[model samples]
Target chain A: MEGSQYRGYGMILLGAVVSITIIRLAYVLYWIGRPLRPMPKHLSTLIVLGSGGHTAEMLRLVNVLQKDRFVPRFYIAAGTDNMSLQKARVLEDSLLENKGIGNKDIEKLAYFEQIYRSREVGQSYITSIYTTILAIVHALWLMLKFRPEVIICNGPGTCIPICLVAFILKVIGVRWSSIFYIESIARVRRLSLSGLLLYKLHLADQFYVQWPQLQRKYPRAHYVGCVM
Target chain B: MEMSGRHQSPKTENQMVFVTVGSTFFDALVKSVDSQQVKDELRKRGYTNLLIQMGRGFSIPSKSSGEDGSLAVDYFTFSPSIADYMRSASLIISHAGSGSIFETLRLGKPLIVVANEDLMDNHQIELAEVLADKKHLFCATPQTLHQTIRTMDLGSLLPYPPGEALPIAKLMNRSQNRARSSRSLLSPPRHFCSNNSPFFFVDVGFTVQQGRTGDSFLGISFSGCVLLLHTARPRLWILLLHLFQYISS
Candidate 1:
């Protein structure tokens, strides 16, 4: 009787393991041949801005995006980052002027909607844990409120929480926002920590690398030539 | 006092050399530049201004009392817009931080990258070597910095093409088309949680079961969920895991 009880426990555990494996495999296979969709006519975009270089690279990419199409651009940056906010404001004004949308009409055009500040990566593991939780709460609230159709970011520590929030939203069927991750140009050989996470988790619907070699290294990642 | 020195001299077109150590203090890089030897070298090269952004916990370069004080060396703890200084400068000398390197490259400025070998990982060294190999930027050590800067021909440095949209746009277009068709076939119910509260949990569980196929899936989901929950209450689970491991041990 004792031996049979042990065996029963083992079988249940085995069954649980097997079931989970099958489910994951099915999901992967289903996504493997998924068809592409055309760029939506109007997209509420959430651009996760990193401090310094990440912000600069994302801004450069944002410059090329059809401004009129990606309306009501929302920016997320680390709480401490004033530079990115300043830069985004400057970019917004210039973008508006370039689109021939005057100061008065800026309310109607593709304007910088709002800037949300998430927790920056902390130095210590314990502090980082606390900050990360705060960041996620902030991110979840933003994701729900913004209800963005598309999300775009270059790899930054702060992007992780926001991306994870998006992933959860997708998983829970809250929203079907497409995540587009553009790996930083500097990451010629390998993906940054955030990039690696998004790639591994299948969080990014579209993952792009700046270098051809990186594309070869990670077959899933598309080699998009020099998006700065 | 230094403000007066800079403004007073409008006649001389001071070839500015911006030496930035980024947010981290690199005493080695700072000390190398602060040396009398480097000072003389810059003077010889006709670089009149040396703006050093010494970030955190580094000794300031001692002011030199030389015959020709034309090399107006200025120090700042930090700047919100280092790019402004970078753009105006003739040449940029920076630590091998990706931020500094790319910003310089983006601005189309000739850059000399000094890798901090003392970093825990040699990733910066690797990055510097790769970038140097591509001729996108010049790499140098403290020993070789003076020589690298002296020999650097700005004209010969490879121009970093401003970011192009075609490659990314094409991939995005392809991915979008694929996503659209996939959505049509396998669209999740619009309100899975709203209509069925208790069933939503069961459905999520079922979704996990359906997706899993091998032993790896269990491991992956276990770790992945922990990672996902890491943003929520990582410390609690971590402590519990530690206790479990301790008791088992």
Candidate 2:
């Protein structure tokens, strides 16, 4: 009797595990396969500004995005700096590798990184001068090359330079805009949602909030949840 | 321009396509699938009129990402023909890339934007979000991307115009009218910023730092690129060095 009862319990445990696995798989399928807006007629180009996981996710969505719209040559990256988004960037790289892509074909690469500061000489400005100059030079090079249309940003630091470049492009008759993700949930990793929210306002073209409290506080924010 | 009716052939009637953005992901799917299956599926899907901008550097994909829906793909290198594709396409789904978006927008056609979170901390998301909120464009995510496509509303969408093209032309004309402000006389920007004027990138106004001998050295004002009362030695040195390099190189 004891042996039979033990077997019955084991079977129940197995059934529970199976059920959970199946449910999770179903959710994944539903999320990935469900459809919505028809792909708009393609723009001259849609430049996805960053690289890595978010980029990978963006790429995954393209399958469905291409239905009515034309899929143009797109950049699949998480962000410029690979260290922060190591995993997602790696996946993007892997996806690229799977396709056997080698290098981007451009005639030349501009290595100039320039930073312009006012005539004032402050400690913070002086300390960061070299790095700032490098960034400017790089920005100018990119400006001359990848004249983008819209710029989307999750944070201000790196995106700012790209924007400066994009703005230059705009000045020269290019069209562009910017967006922000408001990623406090993952952006401030290890920090509690409340604690991380302590900083300044979450700014963006459109703001995405994860928690209800945050949504209440920032009335204008859209609650997209933690898509990551 | 004249209107042309749909051709007798379904292939002829379909729109010719060009992908000026998002090759990174499409290439992966292309590599992972069997070429034969990809061609078959693409044909079946009625995508007889399609072009993938591989940009000359082609990458191959591994087996897994394409295991299920592996077949029905095509990839091509980006070439001058892309200009033609841009002209031909009825739709252009791009990566919100600055270059591609501007050209398409200047054309004043339709557009769909996908911000790449990969570039710099997902700034692209902000770009798409802002444009979408402004009712200038549409945005999507990988998971919900297909849905965005299936239900995409094209009526409200419009292409962006080239940024402030005519005004700057006028500014250039006015600057040309002023002899001192020729392209060569441009000093650093601080002098203009301090004066509370919208400054152009090529605005040339700098303080000439003269010494005891009344020897004048042209200097670029660094402080906010504005309010140039005096000149610093460092910029003078840089100017000299730049000249030296220019002549030597």
lDDT of 2 at B26: 39
* For model 1 chain A, the run of ten residues with the poorest summed lDDT: A113-122
Residues A1-228, model 1: lDDT tens digits: 999999999999999778766664455434532433345677778888877767877888877776767787887777777778678878888987776766986555433433334333337776767767887888888887777767888857778878888766655445557788998776878788889998987878788888788899999888878765
Residues B1-249, candidate 2, lDDT per residue (tens digit)?
222222113543554334445434433323322245443433443334444565433564222323253232244554545556776765555665544654565565455665554443344455456557656556764334445545555566644433322322232123223333231233352222222122233222344456576554555432112223434564665566455444433
Report the interface RMSD that candidate 1 achieves against the true structure, in angstroms: 6.3
Q: For residues B98-150, could you state the per-residue lDDT of candidate 1 as single tens digits?
A: 77887788887778898887776456666678778878889999888888767
For each candidate, the DockQ is 0.24, 0.02
- TM-scores for every predicted model: 0.72, 0.33
Candidate 1: residue A71 lDDT (0-100): 80
On TM-score, the candidate that comes out on top is 1
Whole-model lDDT values for every prediction:
0.69, 0.40
lDDT of 1 at B153: 60
Candidate 1: where are CA atoms >4 Å away? A1-29, A32-40, A102-122, B1-13, B69-72, B79-84, B106-108, B125-127, B150-156, B182-249
The DockQ leader among the candidates is: 1
